[model samples]
Target: MSTTVTQQPQHSTLGECKRWLRVSLYTIFLLTGQCTATLLGRFYFDKGGKSKWIATSVQSAGFPILIPLLFYSSKSTNHDSSKIKRKRSVMFTLYLGFGLMMIAMDFLYSCGLSYLPLSTFALVCATQLAFNGVATYFLNSQKFTALTLNAIVVLTMSVILIALNTESEDSKDLPKEKLLIGFFCALAASATFALHHSLLQLYFVKVAETGAFSALVRLNFYPMFIATVGGVVGLLGSGDWRSMGKEMKEFEYGRVSYVMTLVWTAATWQIACIGMLGLIFEVSSLFSVVVGNLELTIAPILGVFVFHDKIYGVKIVAFLLAIWGFLSYIYQHYLDDRMANQDKSDDGLQVSKGEEQI
Candidate 1:
């Protein structure tokens, strides 16, 4: 008789709780990276040159590279063997639609910044929470609870207060049409962002069972491609093709040594940050929207000290209120999770008792 070998089951290197903690930390880091990149963009613009173009170019530079790296990393860990078999035409259409929406968002946002102050921009962009909520309700069938409504009101009020109290650097009056355009553009961008969020979620479910890397890469591939195209088109259309040439020549000479180094650095950070956001969104529930929008609250407070920006006591109070509201939201989520776990444990006990009776 031949002896047979039995392999012992190996314990997971990381526990589920530890994995969750890692994800939470990574999510926080992603948000911090985004905030840092935003600060870097502000610095790049302050250093002179075309602020808008510099911000765009630098942000674009790193994302194209980081997305692929992170995506491949995610892919390596995924165990799902299923293939996505959607027709090329359909997939291209989805990607193109999403890409164009994002492109429009970027274009409109940059144009808006040309008119509005940073404070105004931040306040307006905060409405993304509202847009995200609405989109989730319609697209994902997530129930709209009273807490969500209350949170929205609190956050909206906070943003309005912040906007009203924001100090302007220029005492001179801005053009009425430009201001209107800026406000509308910013709102449009927020709406588009909401759509982008939902679309990416659906895409994650459809094309990738495990969205660790493939999900991130697929999302960025079209958006970056479109953004690159938009940048090129904008550069050409503005008759500043020379600026494009100059940036490229600088990159060729030694991208790191170029004056656009800050731009490139910011871009890299942005890509990583966004990729992190996508990953978190894929894994978390609706509260992730709340957490993401809280970036508005975090960025401004730091900006006041870091960028010499100013915020009034009223706005600070409003931000605190918003923070309270978000905290309440998180507390509610914790309670729900606790109750759910309890129910699950009780069900297991009932099943065991039924089996004993049998």
Candidate 2:
């Protein structure tokens, strides 16, 4: 479902520059989130402490961000409350659906991480951008121009190159079936995540009439709360609640490290969500995911240092291609903005000339 809002255009170059600045800052947040998440995955899954509850709890990282949002929302007038209520009334179903989707995504991502090696997982994660871009194009009616399409193609090729000689370190000792299961589960998770990005954008465009903070709050808060509940329920129902102690003991680090890892994971993920949501708000969902995918580029280098994951010449070439693709995407957006500003200036000049004639 889509809702339409007649949005005001930001024609001022200052506004564009500010948007870029904000996006850049937010991109850093997303990058931080990706880096931490990569490390946490290596830490948790490699050690076999795969807690579904932790998977869902990690998303609760955004709860702190939600705190400020709640405060900000409270400062608004009663009229704002009424507006929020009306919008919430319409979005009740979407919220519930997406809340459930969030739960599924968290579970899928956990399973994927548990089953795959970090390098292979990173490469597979790149596909989330492709899934997101396609979804935004169709579901959110976000148009991809020729230049942007070229960028997309380059990014796709980069992933292909990265995966061409891929072998999962974790899969070597495991059965062939586990590898296949991990590959497919990771793919499913990526696709489902893409849907989440697009759907959030749809809601942002149509139903989120408040400030960006409030919109972000709504996006993370409800879904996260539901996901946390789901995790708790799943843990209790599956009797995993009783196994928490054993899982912690099994962690490479002691139980304290296990506790610390989960807390760190939760905090970092929250930080990343802020960056992701901010990017989506400042730019587009496709843009945010594209930036988020830079984690793929960084993760391999990190893997080399931390996990001793092997890297080859082919992977280096793939990394360069990914960089080129990222630059191409940014350049296209710059060109679009330049042309837009030029047209606006020309229109202003024409109006001035008409005034003189008058």
Candidate 3:
């Protein structure tokens, strides 16, 4: 009996260690993949890549990388009958709907990246938390804690500060109209991203079970496949396909760099998506977005060095406010974790007392 008690604690500790290790790995993937992908994306535009469809296409065109993982996951979980039980037509519709949404979000983001400076774009993206809080309230039925509300307000202030800083050196060359377009497009993309996460969480709750890694692959794979196809159609329909050779030849870094930039952008975005999905599966959509927002901190700092993005006084303050808001959200999660552990400990104590009485 003593051995059993000792082994139970050790086993529980091991399981927790494994869970945290997984979360840490996922966080690393999310941070590195997203920051690198964004930088590469901005680099593409800076170096003469003009087709937004091409940019959007590359975002999901790397779905092929997920294929091998899908195959492995399928082989490992073939006996798991608790998979998606919906009709084929229904599943197709869901995939199509999500695919179209992904296309819209990607295109909007591409537009933002094309017109805005990378640092401003990253700061604008922080508004996703506010949009996400709203979506979570309506779709996921999540209540807002004080910390979350504070995060929403503080993040909004960060964006407002950016908006007021019109004399920013980054925007000196950009026409006001284009700046407005970039601002609104980035804002729309942020809201769409939030909606996507909430709806995905709802789908997971109502129709799908999140038990296997294969489930994560499928959730990403089909929608990305459709998005890739849509991107191709748009590229062709827009006649950008014809100019691809000219664009590459004129690229500042030469043809090889052009191709490699798009390729790596595609690869890194997929890596980031995998990490984002892993977090959503492991925790909640809100938690996933919080980790994603961490990129806001890293990307801008990198932008200063790579792109020579100006971090003037107002922008710096805005950046600090963004960090403050993110920390508030993190603290809330820390408190929740503490409460959960306390509950688990109480339950274990009750079980032990019952065992002793018996």
Candidate 4:
């Protein structure tokens, strides 16, 4: 009995360590993949690549890369046939709807990136946290705590600061109309992205019956496949497909560079999506978005160095405000974790006391 008791604690500790390790790994993937993908995406526009349809397509067309991982995971695990049978049709419909939403979100993102400077674009994307908080409140029944509300308000202020400072270096060269379009597109994209996260979380909580990894793969694969098809249709229908060859040849760095840029953009975005889905499966969607905001911080700094984007005072202040907002959200998580641990400890003590009394 003593040995069993000792082994139980060891097992629990090991499990906790594994969970933390997985979370850490996913976070790394999210940060690096997202940052690199964002830069490459900007590079595509900077170097004369066009076709928003193509950009949107690449975001999900790389779904094929998840195939091997899906196969391996499937072979390694046993799924309940009854559950799979019950959920297959429902899952398919959900993925189809999600794929359509992804198409809209990715297209808006492409539009935003096309017209906005990379740094400005990244900062605008930071509003996803605020949007996610609101979406989760409605869709996931997430409570609006003080810190969450503060984060939202601060983040909104950051965006407003950016909006007010239109004469900044990044927007001076561009037409005001285009800048407005980019800003609104980015804001809409952030809201759609938040809604996507909330919907995915709802699916996981109420519908998913498989392992986290398996569900992650399926959620990505089907939606991406559908989105890729939709992107191709849009590309051809818009007559942009004909310009692909010219675009590649006219690219400043040559055809090889253009091709490589799109490929890597696709690859890195897929990696980031995998990381994001893993996090959503393992934690809350809001937690996944919080970790993703790390990219918002890093992307702007990288933008200044790589693109030589000018740093205006307003942008700097806005950046600081965004960071403050993220930190506020993170602290709320830390407090929640402490409270949970305390509750667990209390339960353990109660059980021990009951055992002693018996």
The numbered model that scores best in TM-score is 4
TM-score of model 1 vs. true structure: 0.78
* Native-referenced Cα lDDT, model 3: 0.81
- What local distance difference test score does each model get? 0.63, 0.74, 0.81, 0.82
lDDT score at residue 189, model 3, on the 0-100 scale: 99
RMSD of each: 6.1, 5.4, 3.1, 3.0
Clashes of each: 2, 0, 0, 0
- lDDT by residue (1-358, candidate 4, tens digit) is 3454445555656776687688779878888899999899889987998888988898988888888988987987788899778878888899899999999999999889888875577668878987898888888888778997887777667666665564354553689899899999998999999999999999999987777888888888899999999999989999989999999989999999999999999999899998998888777788788778756655656777998876678768877887898789768866776586567656666676677788
Q: In candidate 1, which residue ranges exceed 4 Å CA deviation?
A: 1-16, 51-54, 67-71, 74-90, 167-172, 211-213, 244-265, 268-286
Alpha-carbon runs more than 4 Å astray in model 4: 1-14, 115-124, 154-167, 172-184, 311-324
**TM-score of model number 2:** 0.86
In terms of lDDT, model 4 sits at 0.82
The residue-level lDDT of candidate 4 at 122 comes to 65
- Among these predictions, the greatest lDDT belongs to 4
lDDT of 1 by residue, 1-358 (tens): 0111111111121343555565566567566767676666565445434545545545544555566565576667655333344355666787777667766777777767667787688778878878877887787666666776787777767766666666455322688888888889888988887777766766666655554555566656666676667766766677665664465444533544455556555564655546455644544335555666665666667778997776668767877977987777756655665575566556656666677688
- lDDT for 337 (candidate 4): 60
Question: Global CA lDDT of candidate 1, please?
Answer: 0.63
Q: How many backbone clashes are present in model 4?
A: 0
Residue pairs with backbone atoms closer than 3 Å in model 1 (clashes): 58-263, 59-267
Q: List, residue by residue over 1-358, the lDDT tens digit for candidate 3.
A: 4555556656666776787677778878888899999899879888898898898999999899998998888787744343345455777898899899999999999899788875577668878987888898888887679997887677667756765663354553689999899999999999999999888888777866445587788889999999999999999999989989999999999999999998999999899988888777666688788778766655666777998876668768877887898789768866776687667766777787788889
